[model samples]
Target: MEERVILGTERDFEAFAAAFSRRLHAGDVVALSGPLGSGKTAFVRAVVRCLHGADQSYSPTFTFWHRYEGTPAIDHIDLFRIDDPRESAELGLEEALDGSSIVLVEWWRNAPELVAERRYEIEIEGSGNGPRVVSVRRVT
Candidate 1:
């Protein structure tokens, strides 16, 4: 099933993520896809905060991935710099998806195969300056 919502402000966006966090646990992969400046990172930050109580969120664009400590640790990954599927394999994404933690992936389109069967696929649309439309679907 799919659900959609309009986030009019930063707080609204964060609240939505925080609430959604309750449904997530270890082994869950959240595939986030959107254009640049579409608030994908912001949503990840909010979800991380909900999972661990600290923001400690950063765009993994440069490092490719970062693991944050928590009850169920979060592995934040950015696939924007990846150009090929081989690159993802080299990055050890398959190992990371081994049900060890909650993985949130930005620019997920670059490596859709990494996504697990039980996952949440979220797509955000809109410029950062205005309200954003977030579509959430549970993919099984």
Candidate 2:
């Protein structure tokens, strides 16, 4: 398990994502825990951008999942509207937990069981001046 504290600005988040990208292996699962309007999607964008060397678009907040054919391939999932954990299984969410891709799950508390045994959790809290406080934790 590894962890770090990162800044809240877009650029700082991007830099943090880039640095984290270096340590990612194929079966990496990152669980993002934050309230609405947090920078989960923004941070994911930076990661996908770093992996592909090009810009990827927004999160599939409504559709629930977005796939990016980046250098390492990334699957971004937002479970905000999901009301039940079992619905995740019906939605094929388990497919996202593959060993060949990098998966980032936002609002991951919705379906905690979907997360891998070894995963990274990023918690974002409100800081003064409208910035964010990000805390990274990895399961042991």
- Local distance difference test, per candidate? 0.84, 0.78
Clashing pairs in 2: none
Which candidate leads in lDDT?
A: 1
Residues 56-129, candidate 1: write the lDDT tens digits. 75435348887776778788888999878667777866656889889999988787777787789999999858
Q: Per-residue error at 33 for model 1, in Å?
A: 0.7
How much is 65 displaced in model 2, in angstroms? 0.7
RMSD over all Cα atoms, model 2: 2.6
Could you tell me the TM-score of candidate 2?
Answer: 0.86
Q: How far is 65's C-alpha from truth in model 1 (Å)? A: 0.4
Compared with the true structure, what per-residue lDDT tens digits does model 2 show for residues 1-140? Answer: 44556575767767887877777777899998877777888778878878877756644634889877655668888889888998888777655676778999998889888888888888877644476777888785
- Runs of candidate 2 with Cα error greater than 4 angstroms are 1-8, 57-62, 127-129
Q: In model 2, how large is the Cα lDDT of residue 30? A: 91
